[model samples]
Target: MAVTLADYEKVVGPEVMDEIRTLAGYVRHKSLQNINSTPVGGGVAEILTRMIPLLRELGVDATWDVIKGNEAFYAVTKAFHNALHGHPETITPKMLEVFRENTAMNLEEMKLEGDVLFIHDPQPAGLIDKKPTIGRQWIWRCHIDVSNPDPAVWEFLRPWVERYDAAVFSMPDFAREMPIPQFRIAPSIDPLSDKNRDLEPEVVRGVLERFGIDPERPVLTQISRFDRLKDPLGVIESYRMVRRHCDCQLVLAGGGADDDPEGAEVLREVEEAAAKDPDIHVLLLPPFSDLEINALVRGSTIVFQKSIREGFGLTVSEGLWKGKPVIGGAVGGIRLQIINGVTGFLIHSPEGAANRAVELLSNPELCRKLGENGQRYVRENFLITRHVKDYLLLMLALDHPGERVVRLAGI
Candidate 1:
């Protein structure tokens, strides 16, 4: 069943729904086309999946498209992804050629026609070259933390980025010294999505049993792709440390995105680290396993996002939205989501994560309080409705560049 705006009103209230509709009305004349690397997997795709439908329901003409790329192309982009996250990756001229060639292929095949051409991440950013012919408002949405990106990669991408009408980043710190207008809009989670929805107790129990996780034993879960940056190995180390003091199980569950080529290698490393630990469940769930993920988080006593580097870490919000206390790394957008000691604990190492996990597991009351705080925080700030409103405002702001106040007509 398709989720309607009316369904969201029960969670976000009627006034928020009214505001979204009003904003949509202002931009009804324009059409939006969101282009990203993949249609499934990462936060960018997941967000667009839910957001596009809502935008259309609100009377805005919105469409989404994915750029085509082969394995070689994705491998280069994956390297670029790592480099952008401040990882050390060697970028050769051949790698740059692979990126350009694939982007050229996408440009030749795709029709660049929309009032607003929203290009996401570096994968499809080269499509902006078509802006001269299309003459549309091109917005580059960078979802990675490029605060200290590899100088070579940043230099290569800078020219293309500066050509945009505006750039949107997940954090203010991620913004660079670009000439174009920059907006800081954090990513959000769909409260009613299968991954974050309210699942029945039976469903949660069944999922736990199917995965061989003991329902009675407290489970620590980190739901993210098997990417090195997500630090699945570190999560296992944390789980091992927690085992010494607390008797609990661990669940490391996620799948791959089409654009990511490194998932298989990372999965192998995770499996090796998990190595014969009956208590450790390393699940490589296929795509569209949101319900199982929801159950895993709900069944777990504590959720971990323990990312070494991240873009915004939507799983952190998903776990928090499910009212599970999240312990995440002190990096990237994770810093924005985990409010240190308030909503959740921000750890710097596996030991820190393990210590925090033990603390939460020992005292259920503190866990409850943190979970309550996190749920409220996500409800007020990180829901999909707030995300749409920000985009609507950004669209409106585009019409009146450099104006302090955007005066919409008839209001």
Candidate 2:
């Protein structure tokens, strides 16, 4: 069931996939190598998994490699993540040492030869300093919303970020006033990926029953890493308020990542909060449980990606792609996803989320309408083909700057 370029033609016509092939020809000669911290877990890994192969299909010499990092290194990077998300933390000398040591380790082993070297997130930002040594075009792709970042942490990472040939962010607001040319490229979900493909009703029910969830009850589900920013406990509280009015069940299912150490602590806290509620089903799935997660989301009456801060909660698009209405927090790219009662509702507090959830539960028509609206919206705006097209355009933009007349398959 691995997706090929031709497979994309099924979801988004041969015309669209053909256009991608034509655009890929523009940059087929140059090499593209993507470097990030982990090979699994988190949005970056998930995106690269689907994007790499499709790029190669278009005849681009693209490859993906993961950086080596230990527990201490990830711990520092985790704090760096939180800080960039607007939770300021004191960066210690020990943490700096750990980051540098891991960066050096990766630098020694990794082959820095791609014509376009794409570095993702803060975990491997230090690699930008080595760009001069390799003399290749480097692009720093920031997936976090650093609009109001921790001052100290932003200043510390700014110099390394400035060194890149260009910087790409999810939203314009997410970008800072840096000298480097900045571009906004939102993340996307692959419609043909295991996590977004169509699932049989029996399979959905089986997964729900396996997790001790009642298939008869209307399920409100949230599938994300057990990270604090995802606000899993807050989701439980919101579901509690909705339960007071409607007899709906809640499911919080996610797995841990190697780069995120606090997932265990957050999962434990969520468990304690949902302990008294027999209706709340908590599932800590192991890695590569895409089919199971897909089934869980597909079976839901409604979905939630209630992150306190998000880059682009692909979970929102994943739910929408499955034709389920998503209630997401109004932050970062979440704002870009929700069209205010059209595609889905925008929630601020638990009361807001509860109100929308209750409304959706009360009106089956509204839920169906929103799902229809969102699925179409995503089809036009947020699929893997569009994402690959944008990246290819970025490569072209970087290579041939300021050309009035461009070329493509009439794209």
Candidate 3:
């Protein structure tokens, strides 16, 4: 079910909705072109899928486009992704060549019709090379943590990044010393979306039964891609440590991205890690398994996001939105989502996660309190209504770059 502008007004008040309408009125027909690598399987695509329609309903012409690149393009971009997230990876000259070749091809094929082009991540960053001729306000929205980026990959992508009118990052620390002004726009979740909506008790029960999840024992879930950086194996180790103390089940389920060639390999690694544990359930769901994901989170006793590296852990926000206290890694955007002991515990190692999980499991009152606080926190700060307002303000600011002084004589 697509969220409409009225749905937003219902969550937030009509006054804020009116303000959005007023801001959007300034750029009623100004097109917003969002270009990313894939239209499914990742947070970037998931966010834009929900955001674009709401923007249009607010009177801005918003459209999403995907950049078409072959396997080589994705392979190079995947390595670039690791490098940007502070992972040590060698970017060969051939990889650079692949990046440029894919960019050149996408530049020729993608339509540059929108007045403002928002290129998402390194996958479509080089699309700005055509901005010189396309003549539009281009903004690069960097969703990864570039705090400790690999110098070579940064050098390659930074030139294209500097060409943008502005840049948007998820966290303040993720921002680098770029010449262009940067804005801190945190990612948000939609409470009313299929992935976070209120579900019937029977629905949750049925989903659990279908997956053979024993509700009698506590279920610990880590919902994310089966990628190495997500640390599914580490999550299993943590769960195993916790299992020694309590009877619990572990669910490691996620889908693959078209741009990520290494997902299947990582999935196999996780499978091998859990081969001996009959209590471990590994599911390779389709990219848009919103209702199923929601049910899994609802059925779990606790949710975990043990990522070694993360752009922003949207799954953390999703779990928190469901009032499930998430145990996330103390890295990247997970720090912003899990507020230590308030929303959930942020840990550095498997031992730390196991310790926290054991503590939470023993104290039901503390778990309930943290979960309640987390739900409210996410509702107020991380909902899509707030995200829409921020983007609308950015659009207004970009439209009137020199309108600092509004004349009040008429008023």
Candidate 4:
């Protein structure tokens, strides 16, 4: 069943719904087409899946399209992804050639038809080349932490990125010193979505039992793709460290994106590291397993997003929304989500994560306080309604470039 604005109203309230509708009215005439590498897996696709429907419900013409990529092309993009996250990956000339060829192929096949062409991440950023000829407002939304991206990779993509009318990033620090206008629009989660929606105690317990996780035992989970940047191995290490003091189970659960070719290899590595521990349940969940994921997070005593690098970890917010005190690495968007001792604890090492995990597990009162604070924080800042408002405001701002105040009629 398609979710309506009324459905979201129940989660975000009337004031927020009213604001979204008002903003949508300003840009309803303009068509929005979101282009990314994969239509499944990763936060970008998950967000667009939930967002587009709501945008259209508000009378805005919104559509989504995915750029096609082969295995080799995806491998190159995966390397680019790692490098953009500040990982040391050698960018070969052949890799650059592979990217260009695949992007060019997509460019020829895709229609540049939207009034606002929203290109997401570096994968389909090359699509911006047609902006001049198509005469449309192109906005490159970078969903990665490129503040310290590999010089070679950044240089290669910088020219293409600068051709856009404006650029949007998850954080101000992720922004580059580009000529185009830059905006910081944080990513958000749909509170009403299957992944974050409220679940019955029985349903949560059943899902846990099915996964062989004991409901009585304290559950520590990290729901993300099996990528090195997410540091699945490090998460296991943290679980082992916590095991010495606490009698708890760790759930490392996630699914791979179609655009990410390195998932299988990383999964194998994680499995091998977790094989010795019976309590460490490594799950490679299939796509659209939002209900299971929701159960895993909701059932867990504590949530972990021990990412070495991240582009605004949505899972952190998802955990927080479920009222779980998330212990995340002090990096990238995780920094923005976890407010040290307020919402959740921010850790730099597996030892640090484990230390926090034991503390929270032992003290139920502190956990409840942090969880309550985290949930309220997410409601105030990081929900789908707020995300839509930012985009709508940006579209309106584009109409009056360089203006200090964007005066919308009848507001």
Specify the poorest-scoring 10-residue window by lDDT in model 2.
402-411
Q: Tell me how far the alpha carbon of residue 141 in candidate 4 is from the true structure, in angstroms, after superposition.
A: 1.0
Off by over 4 Å in 4: 70-72, 256-277
TM-score ranking, high to low? 1, 4, 2, 3
lDDT score, candidate 1, position 340: 88
Kindly report the root-mean-square deviation of model 4 from the true structure over all alpha carbons.
2.5
TM-score between candidate 3 and the true structure: 0.89
Global lDDT for candidate 2? 0.88
lDDT of 1 by residue, 49-117 (tens): 999999999888999999999999998998998898888999999999999899889989998778999
Backbone collision tally, model 4:
0
lDDT of 4 by residue, 260-334 (tens): 568888998999998888898999998779999999999999999999877788889999999999999998889
The TM-score of candidate 4 is 0.91
How many angstroms is residue 37 displaced in model 2 relative to the true structure, after the best TM-score fit? 2.2
Q: Estimate each model's TM-score.
A: 0.91, 0.90, 0.89, 0.91
Report lDDT (CA) for all predictions.
0.91, 0.88, 0.87, 0.91
RMSD of each: 2.5, 2.7, 2.9, 2.5
